[model samples]
Every structure is written in structure tokens, then in C-alpha cells.
Target chain A: MVVNASQDDPEKARRFREAALPYLDDAYTLARYLLRDAADAEDAVQECYLRAYKHFDSYRGPAMKPWLFAILRNVCRAEYARRKTAPTAVEELPEGGDQTPMWNEAPETPEKQMLRRFDGDTVRRLVAALAEPFRETFVLREIQNLSYREIADVAAVPVGTVMSRLARARAMLRSAWLAEQEQAK
Target chain B: MTCEEAEVLIHALIDGELDAGHAREVEVHIEGCAHCAVLMKEYQEIRQAIAESDLRYKAPLELRRKIEKALPQPQPQAAPSRRSVLRGFAMGSAVSAMAATGLVAIVLRNDDEQRIENEVVSAHLRSLQAGHLIDVVSTDQHTVKPWFNGKLDVSPPVIDLTAQGFTLIGGRLDYVNAREIGAVVYKRRQHVINLFVAQTANTERKTAKVSTLQGFNIRRWSDRGLNYWAVSDLGADELSEFGDKFESAMRANKEG
Candidate 1:
């Protein structure tokens, strides 16, 4: 509830609105994918904006997208932990051995055809199913189209980590997607 | 470039994050290597599918309005800023402007009441925490009553009602609707009751309405240019009975 004196500047608030409001949809989209809940995404976006306004003076980052996204990521972290303990999200698939997907399956014609035939809902589901770091990287690079360096700014990781996460995320998505297509056939 | 190096750079290349040198190298690798080429094509398709999909969840209009309302407004200063002056000029014709917008005088009473109830209930719960319930702890209304003088815009009525089963506990300042209001505390058996009083424009009296919220009973009424809400875990009947006795004492003091 403590209001910083700088946050109360009308001129500053005006400048913030001009600079930040245009990305509400983008922020909302990132939040929705991150949280997987509509109401939580809305709240996260609102908190992100409020915090951004509070720290508008301190923001000298690369661009507005990464800056707001970094704030949104911080906000979603707590929600993610809370969600992990919640009964709804407790059943996580175990990871090891067979859990690591076999990727050497020959690219049958059907898998390639399915790759070419992009269904919106199916793509969204596969992306949403990805675990963190990967999910976040994919959404930033593919959906929001942020550069890897920009994503690293938001994710607080090295550019190399962003590169690896993006590559791994794409591989995971491709395999999961191709597998799903194989199943449907 | 080797296929291993090209694999790391393919996504960057597709996303146009790579410089021309790296992009051309990755393209050259993909040209001869069918495996890397297929992987590149699949990654491209995935990115394209996501891009073409209608997955961006636009914030609801209500959320925008809610956030706008919640943000702190710039406090008007001694010498009004130009924006404030313009705002004042706009407000000068607010009635006409509001009428034009067809929202001249529609305050949703239910929403306001619902919001206030939540705030007061939250304040009551917070006060229950250790060292938070009272600013001035006293069993005498005389001491509790004077503690609020000059602190608030209006002096809340603090009546000693021990003889009527509710014992004077203490009082404190609590916040509601973004303003500090007086809270007169009392104890009924083991239950604590907070009587929140705030200044209101309504001079007319409204009968006490008892409502249950979060397992706590609240009896709210507006009278004599002040609004009152008595919140407690006591049963509804006992709480309203306490309200009646307190009102009678207030009336008796006024008449005498």
C-alpha cells in the first residue's frame, strides 16, 4: 500500500499509459499461456502494469515488451508455486528413462502431412502442455516473437541458455506434435 | 557450418534474430542435409501454426476499467497542473457530459455494498491478528471516546453499554473505502464486536440490516449523517439486539 512519490506524478502516469497500454493484449496473452487460467492471467497482467507504473523511472531495459514481461514472469512465479501445491495441478508426469521421448522415429508421410496441416487448437494444447522455461521460451519466441536476447532479458538467463531452451522447446513441441498426429492416424 | 552448429541457429534464423552470415550458413547446411532440413521445416510449421492461431487472450473490458480505477490518481497540488485544470473544467460540465454518456447517476448500490462488506470484513479479520485489534485499549467509553477526537472528521458515538450485556472494550481507527473511519470495540461474552462509524452524506435514518459474511454477522445502518456497521461472530439475533440497545442508549443520551 506504500505509494512511492514518483508514482503519483500525473505526467509520469500519462507517459506510462502511452508507453505501456498498447501492450495490454500482448501481456495478457503471455500471462494466459503462463498461468493457464483466465482470471489469474487478468490479475497477473493488472499487477504487472501496476508494478511497472511504480517502477517506471527505474526502467531502462532493452524495450517495453521484455520489461513488462519480466515483471509478469515474476508475478506468475508465486502463482506457479501455489498452483503446484493445489490439488488440481499435483499430478505431474514422472521424468526419466521412457519419460524422455524417443525422437528417432522415422518421419512417415503422415507426420509430415500433419506438420503441414496446422490446427490452431491442437497447436495451442501442445504448447500449453510444455513445462516451464521451455513453455516460456516458446511463447516468447514463437507467439510473441521476441528475440532470444530480449527473452533472456525477461527470463534472467544467459543468451546461450535462451538459445538452448528455444531449441529444446522446439524439439519437444515438434516431437509431441508429430506424435499426436501419429496417434490420430 | 556443421549440422550441429546449424541446429542451434535454425530457430534464430527462422525468427530472423540471426545476422545474415549465420542465417546463410544455416541455410547452406540445411540445403545438403535432409535431416536438418526436415527439422527446420517442422520448427517453422510449429511457429507458423502458433502465429496463425487465434490464441491471444485479450483482457476483458471489465479488467481494464478495474485496473484504471485501482491505480493511484495524481494528487492535486497547491498550484493545479494544467491537466488538473482541464479536468476541473471538464468536471464543471460533468452533469451535461455525464448525461450525454447516459451514465448520469447510476451507482450500483449492490456492488458498492458488496465491496464495502468485503473491506470491513477483511479489516475485522486483520484486527483479530496479534497486536492489531486496538490502538487504544480501554474498558471505559470515556477514555476510548476521547482517543478519536481531532483524528477523524466526525466524532463517532461511543456509548458505554456494559449494563446491557455488551462491555466497552476499546476503539481504533480502521480504513474503509480509502478513508480512515472510527471503530468502537465491545466484547459480548468471548466474541469481539467492531462498530465501524464513518461520515456519510445521508442524513436520513435507515433501519439496521443484519447480514452474514464469512461466518461473521454484520448489522449495518445509517443514521444522523453517520453510517454504522457492527461486525462480530456473535449470532445474528444477539448482534441485532446489541445494535438495538446501543441505538436506544444513543437516543436516550440525545433526548436527555
Candidate 2:
């Protein structure tokens, strides 16, 4: 008898696969955004699944998305530290940036046409451009559609921090979208 | 609600995170306020654009298949040995460390030893990352020793030197030379000394070889059909001393 038996138990493994495998795409998306390298992202996702499986029996959460994502975040974070990469590059909103309606002064393009401009690649690029904690918050909200409470649990930050981060993330995203639109003109 | 009061709530409102009373309050504020209305629309459009863009990366089919196949089971296929079973223990952490900053694309070319050293140093760097310094966390050498019994081909020598300057922190499996090996972790002050041991087919009198790579020093030696590599950012003299202390402790245990 070993300290860990679920590893050798087919039933537990099956349950874990059912609970955790459905979110593989979600996990990959987060990892791809965090690492920005396909190979590295795949490696991180693999590590996340392995780590999650090892501790699957201990998991008692209602949802598997956040729990699995939390594991993935740590894996990518370790990669960041291992590479000794620079800290997340946070872009500050300019003075009165959000005070004025950010999209107000743009040349009068139809809202429909303007939004259609945000193609998949462009949207992904802008989202990826967001800094850490903020980028992570934005992805969890807009992409994964996790509730703020779930996000707070996954990120291990206070609910207030998540709210403020979402606010900042939205502001940053809007401003970045406007800037990109302006450049296109 | 004042514009200032409703400003922060708009995000929650857009996400439908707000309660009925608060959501109504934000709705009231936006109805009366044009600026707030525009802001709300902008946020909604951003969310919509992202959704329409379909940015979620579906895990590739190969990746899905790979993960499904690798899930540990009572009788799993493709995992040939304990080494593969313990491979996850070794790759427990994603890698980033100060030493890894200087890692450029270096061609190992014809030197197999050089390639192995690079990988060993890389594993050391990865283990330094937080939340994964050790998989089996214990200062007790007794507990740490047996953890690798079924996980690895050979049990690595886990020496407890809490009485000495170095403290036996814990142990984890680390990938080195393309095999899952045991890494006995110790800490001297703040520095981590990772002792990686692997089984050698042909035992030879390989004396202690000290080498420095990527801002870390590795002191390696072999004994009784096993190879050992102790890597740390600790000074060469100090790490070598740790290696010496460990070797004697292992010898004394074997003899006595």
C-alpha cells in the first residue's frame, strides 16, 4: 500500500479524465496566452494535467475549470521564473483616458463595421498585449466566462481585487482598441 | 447612483455579476447618463468581439489524445517503466530562473556529455521555481528515501545534515539525460542544492567532477553502480564540501 493509490486505480483515473479532460481547450488557451509559445504552452498544459491528476482525489470543488486553471497558472508561472523573463508589462491608462468616452472621438464609422474590424487574429493580439494579472483577469472573464467569484478563487486574490482588475482590464482593452483603430485610419 | 458610484459596477453589471438591486441601480445610472451608456456599450462590444473572434484555443487533437493516453491507470499502456511513471514528478514545475536568462541556443553538436550537462543544469533551474521545489516535502531522510522505491529504478541517497550547515529539505523526481531520476533537495541558507542520482549500467571509478554552468556549480561523482550530480548556486568550494559530506555519510551508512 502506497501513499497514493488513485494513480493505479482505473476508476479514479476515469473520473479524473471525465472531470478534467473536457477543459483541455480552455487550459490550452490560458497556457498559450501566458507563455506565448506553442511548444512551451503545450508543455505547460501537459504539466498542468499531470499535476492535477496526481491530486485529483483531493479535489472537492463543484467546478473543474478554475481548479485546473489554477494548476496551469502555476506551471506557466514557474516557466516565467525559469526563463527569468521580465515581469508582466503593464500599460497605464493615460490621464482622463477613461473619463471621456474612449470611443467617442473616433472618426464616425458605423459601430457594426467597427466591431467587425476586430478579427480573430486582431482580437487575440490585443488581448495578448494586456499585462499580467489584468490579462489573466480579462481572459477568465471574457474568454472562459468564469464568474468573478470563481475567478477570485482561481487567482487567489480578494474579490475586490478581481473587480478592480476587471475594471482596469476593460478600460485598458477599450483604450487599446481605440488606439489600434486610429492607427488603421 | 452617481456616475462615480456606478463606474466600477458597470463591469460587474456587464458580466451580470451584480445583484438585482445593484444591477437596477447601474441600469438607472446608465439610462440617465449618456457617457455611462457609451461606456457600457463599449465594454459589451469588446466582450462580443472577443467571443465572435473565437479566441479560445481548443486543445489540438494530438494533445488531447496524448493526455488521455498518458493518464495514469492500473494497467496503462505505453508507459514502459517506473521512469515514465515518475516522469511527471520530475516535470512538476514550469521552468524560469535567473540562470536560464543567459541560455541562448547552443549547439551541443557532437558532445553528448555537453548536452546532458545542459539538460541537468536546466532541470536544476526549473526545480528552483516556486511551488515545486520538492514533490515529497519532508526533512526526514527516512521518509524521503522510500518515496522513490517504486518511482525510480534506484533509491537516491537522501542525507540529513540539519545538524550540519546544510538541511535536507525534500526530494522530487527530475528529468535528466532523458530519464526520470531522483533529486534529493537540500538547502544551505537560501541556496538549493539538488542532488540528482541515476542508475549506471557500467559502474566505474568516476571521481568527483566539478563544473560550472549557467551561474550554477555541479559536483558529480559515481559509486556502487550509481551516478550522482549535486547542483547549486552555492560557491564551488561550499557545494563541493556538501558533496563530500554527502558521500561520506552515504559510505558510513553503507559500511556501518
Q: Write one digit per residue (lDDT tens) for candidate 1, span B155-206.
A: 6889999999999889988766545689999998999999999765334478
Per-residue lDDT value at B213 in model 2: 94
* Maximum-DockQ candidate: 2
- What TM-score does the A-chain of candidate 1 achieve? 0.82
Model 2 docking category: acceptable
Any residue pairs clashing in model 2, and if so which?
Answer: A79-B94, A79-B95, A81-B96, A81-B97, A82-B95, A82-B96, A82-B97, A83-B96, B90-B173
Write down the worst ten-residue block by lDDT for model 1 chain A: A96-105
TM-score of chain A of each: 0.82, 0.80
lDDT of 2 at A64: 94
Stretches of model 2 off by over 4 angstroms after superposition: A1-8, A85-116, B73-256
Evaluate fnat for each of the predicted models and list the values in order.
Answer: 0.60, 0.69
Please give the range of 10 consecutive residues that has the lowest summed lDDT in model 1 chain B. Answer: B74-83
Candidate 1 residue pairs in backbone clash: none
- Model 2 iRMSD vs. native: 4.8
Clashes of each: 0, 9
